[model samples]
Target: MRFAHLRVEGQTTPRLAVVEGESAIFLDEVMRRAPRDLQDLIEQGPEGLARVRSAVGAAEPGTSVGAAEPARGAVDPVASDPAAPGTLPRHPVADLRHSSAVLRPAQVIAIGANYAAHASELKLRSETAMTIFSLWPNSLTAHGATTTWPEDLTTQVDYEAELGVIIGRPARGVHARDALDYVWGYTVVNDITARDIQFSEAQWSRCKSFDGFTPTGPVVVTADEIPDPQELWLTTNLDGSIMQDASTSEMVRSVAEIISLLSRSATIPPGTLISTGSPGGAGYSRKPPVFLRDGSTVTVSIGGIGSLTTHCRVI
Candidate 1:
């Protein structure tokens, strides 16, 4: 199943909805006391997800129960309401605005240099410890949102396409082989970075935590829908050129390994978004270095999970 936080353009609050191909079934309209957001739903555990599935049962007239669903699609996001319970309204997803995919997450943790190719391209040693950093909540934005950064602070702004993992439950001392059991779902992330600030700073959070630096989602696909996280492909299209392209399989450490390693010391809480790092082809590493300028439209996509597009502006 796929989920997202969507709202009508003028609405102040985002509604939690079950995303279909081009439309959405808002859980609030179908179920009484629906989980408020993806984070809330995940915290309710498997039982809550079961209740949602049951509430949205056959909302799509022709879709068979337990049918093979698309991981998720390009959902700009929109909503509508049905008059009664058990009868779900199909809102045209293209008409809605989005909030960050994982709102009110326990925390946002990012893994750097997990992909050997990306590490090699950036000249970061991947042979040592995992490079982990925190992304401030202010950095979280949504699909189709505009991210503006101070012109004086950065010129070498770059994009990193990464697969985001949402933790389903508390995890501590879990083994890599069973680490996925704690995964609730996945989303696409554009880890926008300020190349100049990044190089000058000792810590990464501040450089990458500028408001709207981390734009996530269009939708989040359940872990069950993704049979193997490692096999997915990732890409970054800056304006019109394909700057970054590689498969998640090329990561120096797999998703399960990252989770297992993280859980070793700290308890990973439900709804914690772990951006599992990016692959090779960062613009900063390109021959004639490419950077995000004013009016840039960057789209990062993870096959099956959907694409996240962000507009850029210099303030």
Candidate 2:
């Protein structure tokens, strides 16, 4: 099942909802004790997911409370095309505003130099031990939102398309082979960065964690729907140009390995979001060096998870 945090225009608070094709069913309206958010649902474990599945399955046709079965061999489509036709109190997804896919994750961890091509382009080495860093919560923003930074502070703002993995339970000393079982779902992430700060500082978080730097989700696809995370394709479009194009397969370390490695020293708490790094073609690596500027619109997409778009404003 696909889950999202959505709110009608003018509403300050976002409510948890299950998304079907082009429409959404707010959980509070359909169930008495609905999960307050994706974090709550994940914390409830398998039983919570089972309950949600049962509810969606039991709904009658023409109602907003039904689930749309994904077609075999097809990558999940981003937003449902044109609102679905039905009598149910279905609201058009297009009309709703989005909050961050994960509003209250336990923590946010990012991997650097996981993709050899990206490492090479930026003149960093991926052959060394894994590069890990923390992102500030203030950096997290919703899809279709605006991300702005002072041009005087950073004229070289850039975008990195990445796959985000949300941990379902506390993972401590997990084996690489069993790491996939610990994941709750996947979301698309645009790891926006300031090249100037990145190159100048010894550490990375501040350069990449500027307010509204990380834009995640249109929605999060549950783990069961994705059989293998390494096979997915990822791409980035800056304005009208396809600047970053690569596959998860190119990563020097796969998702499972990164999880297992992190779990060895620290317990990866539930609700933690791990951005699995980006591929080559960063604006900094371009011949003329492409960077985000005033009025720029950037979209990052992973095959199964929908595209995450962010409007850029430079002050």
lDDT comparing candidate 2 with the true structure = 0.86
Off by over 4 Å in 2: 64-88
The alpha-carbon deviation from the true structure for residue 131 of candidate 1, after best TM-score superposition, in angstroms, is: 0.7
Give, for candidate 1, the lowest lDDT window spanning 10 residues: 67-76
Tens digits of per-residue lDDT for model 2, 1-315:
889998887777888878887887676655556678999998889988776675555444466422322121221121212122342245678888999988899999999988999999999999989999999999999999999999789889999999999999999999999999999999999999999999999999999999999999999899988899999999999899999899999999999999999999999999899999999999999889999999999999899888999999988
Q: What are the clashing pairs of model 1?
A: 77-96, 78-96
Q: How many clashes show up per model?
A: 2, 0
Superposed model 1: Cα runs more than 4 Å off:
62-86
Best by lDDT: 1
**What's model 1's TM-score?**
0.92
lDDT of 1 by residue, 1-315 (tens): 999998865677887999888877777766666788998999999989987887676465543222123223222123222223334567778877788888999999999998898899899999899999999999999999999999887888999999999999999999999999999999999999998999998999998899999999989999999999999999888888888888989989999999999999999999999999999999999889888889999999999999999999998
